[model samples]
Target: MPAKRTALIALLAGALYLVVGVTATDSLLPAGARGGDTTTTARTDTGLVRGTRTATHTVYQGIPYAGPPKGAHRWAAPRPVRPWAGVRDATRPGPLCPQVASAYADVASLEEDCLVLNVTTGASAAARGHAPVLVWIHGDGAVGGGAYFDARRLADRGLVVVTVNYRLGVFGGFSYPGLEGSGTFALQDQQAALRWVRRNAAAFGGDPGNVTVAGSSFGAAAISGHLTSPGARGLFHRAVLASGEGMMDMPAGAMGEGVPAYPHYTWRTGQESRDTGVEMTSSLGCAGPDPRRALRCLRALPVKKVLEVPDIMNAFQAFAYGNEVLPELPEAALGQGRFLRVPLMSGATLDEHRLFVGMAHDAIGSPFTAGQYARALVTAFGRDAETVGARYPVTAFPSPALAWSTVVTDRMWARGTYAQATAFGRRTPTYAYEFADRDAPMYLPLPGAFDFGAYHAGDTPYVFEDPDAQKYFTDAQVRLSDTITDYWAQFARTGTPNRPGLVRWPRFEPGGAVPHTQSLGPDRIGPVDYAGEHRLDFWRRLAGQGTSPAPRPTEGKEQMS
Candidate 1:
């Protein structure tokens, strides 16, 4: 079968399992529980789960870490999975959580019974003391993603890898008048998964106390949440935040506030999220004078009905803060030194926002004209638009579109990523990086005219066995992939990214005038003047509404090889 067909079949099978798991009564207490060898039939606290061992490792898929957050359990903290009676098959991955369809992923066929996880351990991991547990939280914009990374390679390097799925959209974030913990259901689900890992890491030969939480993009955003969440304390001892950080702030407001422009990493208060839920209640045909009745009615609606409601469905892409789970904005928490000080490896692709700009160009079927570029800055940054345009002039780049890409990359991602990394470094052992392969693979289509150098999510292939890597990587890129995995595994094992013979990734020292960041690319790993290269000072000044300072021309030279 074709790859797409096979993947679709797997997804359909997940939906089928979803039906079987949630048909009549409490779904967490699935009837079957497997009891066999510890490797193949590890006994979790809840029940026996029969996992499949591959030629190189033990693979366990679709293990329930939490009870189904459906029916009476919807919008509540995940209940512990009830013990089962017979052996349960742990071969196939669980259903993908509900999410909005995008140009990248179409998860319309999935369901709400998606709180599941997958684990991969080295072949001898069960022998004891060899494998360190790496719990992965897949990236999503609070909306779409599932636990499907092929971590066999990472596992081969003496690690036990765990991937997880959490609720998305309204099912994950809706908060209203009577809902006690409504705004943070997805976060609660994450904590539940961590709790499960803490309880069962030993069965798979994973060290419970050495757990490392890692994620990319939105997953990094989530790790940031966990870093700040008091409820998540002690669940994991180390973190790897890729592409996004916990304290990333966008101008706070509505999702569509920027329209054709993108919003910064802003979040909502519980009341704001509740108000959103109120509007959603009416949108879903559940509106009434009684708040309790409306919520009850909303919960009673079929999953498909919720999916069919466009706004409620799309709302999965955002999460709300200021609740018990989040309490305050993560950035604020981190700034105030109110976050867990763990070993952190956080970084982003050099041209992070270029992918989005490429998509925008693809949307209009043309490059951004100078006028359009100016208009966007004005729209996104308002009175400061001229300062932004003056700093990132169209004449300096190949086209106005590329200039716009550079502007946003530095403005929203680079500067804030640096600031947050610096903030964390003051309190924790922090390592920072930037994937600077200017000719990095184009995971998505862009006009041949546009080069999305080190585009958003560019580092993903280096970390996970994404099919795109197999499909697009050159021989040199594959070598880089190996190097990248080594860095990731080393970090998970020791809370430091350095190994015997690679570029020494320096710790981010914020008290200094210059911030040192590593650059990862094909056959290249070294330090770069990251702040100067991205003109971060200019962005900081612009954001501060102060006189903009021109950065010396990008220190284009690598400090080390």
Candidate 2:
């Protein structure tokens, strides 16, 4: 490959890693501490499990919600775990699902029996009666597990929080021509966990009927899938989607060279998934005239051998449509208002694509030049390159990289966010927000000169407790964290993120004279003209005038996982 091509591929790979990746902490407990108060116990559907009790919260870790998806169950839908006889120790988290480490993400694992969940509740949860349940799904379709997030802070806010681990990468999403659960095993795993919550939440002093599903990035996209999935209906009464790609469509050359645009960035038709799986089978030495035989051979392979296949995990990151779990594309379902009528809170960070762009250029010590920026616009927007360039001139930004980041951020992230918010607002009670804390702390261990201005997943540390995050936060940021946590807790409790003391968050009204998307910054937290700020009108006009290329129905290879 040419130098430029290699750089482009590296750039795309880094961007994909940042989009799906999240920092994983080793332990949420104090260093060297074996366990907390051992008397804290909850009876799960399987059996009684002992948990740890801290000053603020009671945590039950590594509680199996479903049977291990190993061996013959590798690509099959999740099943219930066999009931245990005695009190099980829920002191440590389970191993992560199968995945490989990358430049941006440092976590890796080959464990297939990772279908477990962690529950956190206030120390006085039993005394507080049944608190609302918040089931959290971690981001990164191929990497990162539920244990990465510490839900103690959220749990302390008078709610029962549950973080779950399902399958990841090929284990989660691999599809064969005649696979029974083609392209939906991960989703099935999530649904199974939710069902577990419904059955056993009362044991943890949680109100199962008032469950809220929440996540960021890929996890948010999964929540979007749940919103449309018939299997997920009534499992969650509320939803929170942060930096989700529910309505996102990829642009040409946006991810890498020769990468075509996709109409649905996070979805694949069953046929497309099966095609990718067939290609994988051929590469894995499991190809045969019969699809069933090929699938059996693939499933029989060792976990390490299966994971050794390059790009296998990322290839199956997308959820497959035309199946029972997700009968149609989530984007189409949202556009047609054919989804669950649950209250929703959806938003994105101010600089959603900066982390991707920064990791691509600045982190790698290759500063993006003005020439490269111009070429990127042409590559991404095609005939509308001139118009896009004119709108986002290099002179307006601090650096060429930032300028390019803004272009994609506005065109891709903001436009999709606005569309999703509008779609949700039209039919359901919707609350839209923008995490605009430009100086938010950078929690990821990324070495770069780039300014990550409230980049993608920046708000995660605020909602979940990260021990190292406090050292980077100022007093104002700490207050901002509290406010965000309060808002989320309120949303989880009552279907709305409003309270008497906090800044009033207005419900999103589509087509209103002035939109009410709350801009969440350290200094100011109130409604802002989100559409105007992101120049959604320009994008709508660009699409209306047919300057932007129409997204292809499906792509042979996915650009981002």
| Best of the candidates, TM-score | 2
lDDT tens per residue, model 2, 1-561: 011123344334434443333344555342113444555777877999988776667788888898888778889989879998989988777788888877666667888899999888887886776899999998767777787777877887899999989888778888888899898898999999999999999998999889999998888999999888889867988899999998998787665556667778888888888887877656688898888788788889999898777677777767888989998988999876778888899999999888877876787688889989898889898899999999999999999989988888899999999889887877778899999998977655567577989888888887887766667888999999999999999999998999899999999877578779999999999989998998988998999933222222221111111
Q: Tens digit of lDDT per residue, candidate 1, span 411-479? A: 678877886787677677789988877776654423355676887776775766655445678888888
Model 2: lDDT to the true structure:
0.81
Question: What lDDT would each prediction earn against the true structure?
Answer: 0.70, 0.81
lDDT for 379 in candidate 2 is 84
What's the true lDDT of residue 56 in model 1?
Answer: 66
lDDT of 2 at 520: 92
Any residue pairs clashing in model 2, and if so which? none
Best by lDDT: 2
Candidate 1, lDDT over the whole model: 0.70
In candidate 2 the C-alpha lDDT for residue 385 amounts to: 95
